[model samples]
Target: MQIQEKIAVVGGGSWATALVKILSENGAEVNWWLRSPEDVAHLQQYAHNPRYLSGVRFDLDYVKPSTDLAETVAKADWVILAVPAAFVQQALTPLAQDAFKGKTLVSAVKGMIPVQNILITDYLGEQYGVPAEHQCVIAGPCHAEEVALEKQSYLTIGSHDIVRAEQFCRLLRNRYVKANPLDDIDGVEYCAVLKNIIALACGIAHGLNYGDNFQAVMVSNAMTEIEDFLHAIMPLPRNLTGSAYLGDLLVTAYSQFSRNRTFGNMIGRGYTVKSAQFEMNMVAEGYYAVQSIYELNKRLQVDMPITTAVYHILYERFSPALEIDILKDKFK
Candidate 1:
């Protein structure tokens, strides 16, 4: 189960680039898939990703860059899917179901499959026929920006199989990075999705002129909502305060590196949804996650007031100010 044989990182975005940097730093042979030929050529010629995490350079000899998704994936023993959740289906669409058969699939995505309203691992399993044992998720308080700076960060490798988790974890561990393997695959992945939505709520609060006093209460309430939702949907015997859950939530909600928070800030500052999305030029994840979770919760019936408030403002066109006012009453 060791990932040293061959590993492919499927995406060229900041997270994907950061992963490439980490793997390359470990001197592991990496097969990289970026959508653009121009970008691939740029990486080859310049030893760095042209679009995202451009500051982190790679050792050219240790990496192979490709635009062929199926071929790249087929060659790897492990495939780390780092593309945006929205484009994941499209990126892997060229591959046949059997392409992912024996390879371990690692999800570096934090968003849901919008069409299926399911976690990325579930989507890969159902859509691509990859088995549950073959799937893993990378959850974090770790951000690509921080990773690029070589700042200390912690990551949780969530999988049902501890062997696979430990193998992947070994590849990610280094001086500035710490990796832990967890058995709570469902809870970890679901919490990763939930936290992005909560971060958006926090960002909206900040943009709408809510002080630190209210923002503190809002994040605390958001954690309870996360606990309630995961407990109902997953029911795993796990600590919600751990880095994968609460730590991830705090970083995304408070860090300047969070795109979800940036998106919500724009919304709160009077930008339309289309405009905010357009200006960012990157998927916020929470924008899509809120819809998926809102629909999923219709059946689960979790008491997620913060999530509901975000859903109303983002999807139902409710004013951010009015929604926050209403949300405050639910928090205490």
Candidate 2:
């Protein structure tokens, strides 16, 4: 008998639940690190995800949801970090002592760290003691909503090591999922985070009943800003007008499945940021990411007009109506 490499999924959220489903389909042994003992016991006892990805059930045979981080990643060959970017450091810190030793680490979180103003991978390497080459950033136009449906979605598994990127892609690729490889880790991560902010702006336009033509222009202008922003951070090319960039922005900005878009709709309908979060009971990456981008724009002296508008609407008591008009003017 041969032993297969184990894959541990860190986080018990919707995205984790969905990825577990896909990883199981990929024929890998999965250990899901639950948020707490209570979550582990509840799912272990009921075999269902009641809190986050409701209506989806995990097959417990090769999948074990546990609260023990050490036990989850102990012998796993590949560990996927699926927690919100806000919680990535905290989640990985407890295991930093001895667990995950010599294991490949992959990140699915898109938002940036507020203090460091860097992507999760950068923070992982700079602050978390993970070897830079061992870190792989899985990015692109992927949304958990599509994964939950077992629908086809493409991802760019980016790393400095092309061989490792392709290896992980082989582990993650599936019928409904295509894993493409990329050499630009920072560029992909930046696009992933900024696209969320861009989408929040588009969602506001949509909730205000702005038509498609208006949104097309808004998204185009936002992408241009994103291209400029990406080039400023990483020397990667700024052809963000493509699928990985535009495709993701479309789903995040327009889809009903986007939590950020949903958050935007609520805000456009007269809900505060805090209230919107409490109502959703799920992590809207954009809500947490806005703080980082707002500070970045101020520090870099770069004009991320959309993020600035969202920051005003969210914190400064600027009317969404006024913000919308001001944003529209920037493109013209």
Candidate 3:
């Protein structure tokens, strides 16, 4: 597909808003799908996302907001899925396979589907028959709040087809955003999921009174944990130290804007899982990711102490303090 082809962005969250902001910079007429017609109307009227990144206004000339999924997807040659992973299935349920046919699909969702235990790319292929070549993953050391501030940020776009990846990157790249192309789409997407789990662990450590000294060690070990798990599953030749892997981990683990970390902080501070989720009013993807990884590991059985600790605290109803105390013995 050409850069001039009509593009659609799915979802109405901060990341989706940031992406639409990036697209608007190029003066592209973007078809956007939101579940709430009220949100669509608000965006159209105010030229800004009502719920997220409200400070970043849009150019109405470049945005066509709609609530109809099939109509929006059918109109665009490229579709970017930016919804929270937990909601992506529901988001796509209304669209038939024909809507995705011949469309270049990009996944900005970092978390996996809990029920399927697969990557977003994999899920689309399985559920909608979208080919691997048509799929791409957008990963970041970038956050929406920072993008809204016009700060320089780097994004790694991973696809089996590097040319398509580069084309999509061109659509997103600008003064404040730089995009790099890579062939390890599977590895990059998996790292994106794994890092959030690690970030939650970092936040929990901080809330439990663990200092930077301990966190530094945990993060270093988290990197190793991520490498082990991805390599075991994909066995690809990859540089896990790259920005898409390590840099993403560092930012999410420490960023004040990370919802996963914030969620873990609440859990560390003694909020029950349900209570923490309720209070956050945001999806902490790592909470779902840790469980998916735990189940996937039942067969792979990689020795992931960090993921196990998170899984225990999140799923097994174990005390975060006790689980953390036990986790300390595993760290070097």
Candidate 4:
């Protein structure tokens, strides 16, 4: 736990590559894991990830590449999960064999399973038995491109263990990546998933050429809905108003870097839901989260109006423009 003696960056994705860059810049002896042997060879040889975060070169000397999961886990004092939302449960299942060795489990995933309706955090807990006490959830407005470019960005690290939390913070804090220690692990996790749903809505509005007034109203109502939703599960005081919530929502909804925004924007441009998803290629967390949240509403009965609208647009084949009009009517 002291400065992440040997770190494993799991999954061969843009976020994982960006985090490996962070670790390398911070002088971490990190083993970066790619699912493909070819990717491993490229990173080990050329220091590049062509499949995911292409065009961003890494410092291969500081970081080693491994296609073997067990080999990477064996060398890790901490393992960072960077897989897509749908793959998270499968990713954690193999780790149940004590492969992680009770090391710090840090997740960068922000989506849920559409079929099971499970949060990535809870799924990891159940499958890998990574107790709530040892798990860390990192979420923020940081983009992989920005981190790859070494642009200034910060993210939140919330763990049940304050000591591990602090050490992880110090380990990842760098000139380019700033890690902040926080106490609300659950709030951070839920906010990370839920905010993407709102971002999709914002992008849809923008794609439809709805002016800033419509975007303003939708996001404002969304913030209130998210705060209420997070509060009902447990007690979340002022933390929801911070970066993990509004800051993330604002940027993801407005920024062109967001795949969720792009996904929604295409939907607004009159693309079918499947077409939108097919074009994006990347897993849009909000697309999955909306379905999960809609399923959750059956029991929780919390009014996530924005989420409901997005769900209708994505799943029910409801017209995106009509749904926006409906959300406007309901929230207005």
Candidate 5:
């Protein structure tokens, strides 16, 4: 594992920590950025993140923890954005527009711009002038928790440049992890966003005590809903049954580790949105994603019953029980 790639991983969350662990363990130099000074100090001293995946220790010689955004991005050949979508703008505000000019940007975020409703790659292209070929997205049936536990996991690197994607994939693959490249960047990214919404819907159903049989119908109907929406927006030919699309959807919907499902279950079990968010203390990307997708659909006019049902319950203050019951009639 004698690699010479210098990577910059932005954000201090579990996913960011996990990426740093993988890359550094594989012998790449990682310039890690964290918002909090205390977390940086903790990682530098303890060789582990105090707040996230603390059990996994890092080799400090390969990991350089820092708080300076510009310096972190300046030294890396590749920059991975692992921050939540809601704070993406704020997180990168300190850097100049041309900061990412020659660097390969990888988005590990499974969300869209909240109100603008654009993908991360789109936003990077528009705001920073990064081209489609220079950008990549990390899609998963893979979760950070599993990565920390050394459980077998699979990841899809979606990019317009398949060669570049494959090159990047080599940096990720190891015994417990398998990385593959996909040419359908837009399709993969959009599926990542939509699946979170589906997970929330599934969580809500589970919270309502709807059994596996009912959820099976919901997931099946959701696959159709996703197909229609992707066609309406991107109009690309893609296999939704791939690991990046349906596998990711199924995992997020059913995994006990899904924060989105936990959030939805709380909402279904009589907790308000605010209360659930407060209690969990983590960002469930689906909560923000549902709103963006819902608002975007107003113009696209796609028939997304699951997304619509989620938006109604989360945004419009519709009763969860009422929404789920109504959603039941729409599903086959």
Candidate 6:
């Protein structure tokens, strides 16, 4: 007889709802923490998340929805952080330093901590004392909208402890979802962060009327940029061509569901940063990530033109056309 896995999914977003669906469907008891009390009430009453994925229903017996962060986390052995990167600190602020003392911390977040410029796994280790071996990162070529529709999706679990990563993978694998475990946690996490910036760049190019041919060249060059940045930061022995890295980049850069790309399209189409954000009503992780990565590279001095171009257009208030023109000259 196998023991049931109790998992806590922290966030009220589509990704968090999608994760709760996967785990609960796989027979794990899910303690879902949504910041909105109304959303929690709706999920419990309707067996569906009102805000994000309303179509996918949950089995209430296996999924417990809660508004209390601490209580949600207390009930699970594995806690998956799926909230947007900008809100992560605020969301977990209510917990004590040792609150995650013996649990496995999994980060489904793909952006760096704003101002602090650290990965989610690093923040977990520093703030909550969760050791690296017990921490994991969820990488995609996967999307929440696809998961809700039961479309084929693949996920990569990156962790320092491969065995523990594989254990979590078992909970995620199902009919339409395939989960694989990789040993390079930091490398995978960094690639996830970088891919969003690339996606934004692609969106900017598209909005500027740069056709598929030009975007293809830009994406190819962006891969080289990702390789350079990853080598400088982590210097791990890993394959960048793998689905966790390249596949994820391709999807985010081209997918209609990518908020970062949508956010960038608005910028390229002549919307101000604040205006784009206000209109979308969603957090594009790359908006926060570009600033963090740009500042970090000031010390590391990595040649990240796409990241630099995004930071300039977003933060320095440069014209998207001007920046993209300058950026294209540098790409092969």
Maximum-TM-score candidate? 5
lDDT for model 4, please.
0.81
Residue pairs of candidate 5 with colliding backbone atoms: none
**Residue-level lDDT tens digits of model 6 in 29-123:** 88999888899889889999888889999999899999899988888899999999999999999998988989999999989988899999989
TM-score of each: 0.98, 0.94, 0.98, 0.94, 0.99, 0.98
Model 4 alpha-carbon drift over 4 Å, by segment: 1-4, 93-96
For candidate 4, lDDT tens digit of each residue in 57-145?
Answer: 77666688987787888888888889888777666555545665578889888887668887766766766666777889887878888
> Tens digits of per-residue lDDT for model 1 on 198-222?
8899889989988889988988988
Q: Model 2 lDDT vs. the true structure?
A: 0.79
Tens-digit lDDT track of model 5 for 112-158: 98888899999999999999999999999988999999999999999
Q: Whose lDDT is greatest here?
A: 5
Question: What lDDT does each candidate get?
Answer: 0.90, 0.79, 0.90, 0.81, 0.94, 0.92
Per-prediction CA RMSD (Å): 1.5, 2.1, 1.5, 2.0, 0.6, 1.1
Off by over 4 Å in 5: none
Q: Which stretches of candidate 3 lie over 4 Å from their true place?
A: 1-3
Please give the clash total of every predicted structure, in order: 0, 0, 0, 0, 0, 0
- Per-residue alpha-carbon lDDT of candidate 2 for residues 1-332, written as tens digits (9 for 90 to 100): 11255999998888788878778766778999987788888888888777776666777886888888878888588889889998877777766544655888898887887677778887777765678778788775777767877778988888888888998888777778888787777777778888888777777777777778877888888877887777666666555656667777887777778888888877877888789889988888887687788887775667778888888888786898789888777884
Quality of model 1 by C-alpha lDDT: 0.90
Per-residue C-alpha lDDT of model 3 across residues 1-332, encoded as one tens digit per residue: 12455889999989999998888777677899988988999988888888899998887877899999899998888899999898989889898866799889999999999778999999999889999999999998989999999999999999999999998888988888999999999999999999999999988988899999989999998888888898889998888789998999999999999998899888888889999989988788998999899999999989999999999888888888998898888899
Which residue window of length 10 is worst by lDDT in model 2? 92-101
- In candidate 2 the C-alpha lDDT for residue 56 amounts to 68
Candidate 1: count the clashes. Answer: 0
Off by over 4 Å in 2: 1-3
